[model samples]
Target: MRLGIIIGSVRDGRFGEGVAQWFIPLAQESAAAAGDEVSIEVIDLKDFDLPVLTSATVPGAANKQYVDERVQRWSAAIDACDGFVFITPEYNHGVPGGFKNAFDSLGSEWAEKPVAFVSYGAEKGIRSVEHWRAIVSNFHMVDVRTQLAFSVFEDVDEQGSVAPTDSHADRARALVGDLISITGRLVTTR
Candidate 1:
């Protein structure tokens, strides 16, 4: 199984990178323990610089025929993954606009895939994760309930770095395990 860990924040000093850096290795370890051949990759939203939804056709009907080069690349990247882990930051009790735009730019690529969330912010980004659940449902994506959230006040340091607790590591393992298990079952249907 190929898993894409999407860094959904693109701010200049976003904390999502730190979270991804911490989570990736742990996820790999969990996959190894599960005895599944999972290949993981980081899909940074910053690399794509995707524009807001501007194509003439709706994403679901576009058939992956996006005119924008960046969107096309984004589509290809998402299409290659069997499942995803979205590392996001909460902005004003919701998901970052750029992240939501990046998500809206794809359709069938996300269909039937499993997804997990790891979010950070004032409220541990739980509200953002909750909002994401409704949006991903539009693509019929299966979102795992085992999420890992980090509070800005508690899980971050003075240098604006992530300082996850030991318990967070256990949550990461459980999230990855659930994602892998669900992806294994769902990928067959796709």
Candidate 2:
């Protein structure tokens, strides 16, 4: 299965990239151990500079008429993936505006796909996850209940690097394993 590790933060000096870097290899190893052939791709929101929603037509699971080229590109990427792992940072107890905007840009590509989250922040970014859970459900995406939440103060090192300990790896393994299992079933059915 093609799994997208979407970097959900676009802020300067964001910690999302480091978390993503740490999680990718762990996910790969876990999937390999499970005898699942999975391809992990990093989809950074920064690459697609999707503007905030200003369209008259509301984007939904059935609507795919995106006027912007960037939106189109983002949509295509999502369409190619069988599942997703979102690396998110909490901003004011919610998801980053850019990450939310990227989702708003296009629609339907996420339907019936499995999504997991690896979030890091002061509060482990659980609030962001809560917000995303409610939102992604609108697109009919199945979310894995097993998620990895990294506390910035605990999981991240003083040098601003994601220095995950053994426990973190175990959590990632569970999350990735669940993602692979769920995606495998969903991909075949979809």
- The lDDT of model 2 is 0.86
Query: Each prediction's TM-score against the native?
Result: 0.96, 0.93
Candidate 1 CA-lDDT value: 0.91
Weakest ten-residue segment in model 2 by summed lDDT: 56-65
Lowest summed-lDDT stretch of 10 residues in model 1? 156-165
- Error (Å) of candidate 1 at residue 150 is 0.3
Candidate 2 runs further than 4 Å off: 61-63
lDDT of 2 at 163: 88
74-185, model 2: which lDDT tens digit per residue? 8889888999999989999998888888887777888899999888889999999999999899879999999888888888688878887888888889998899999999
**RMSD per model, one decimal:** 1.2, 1.6
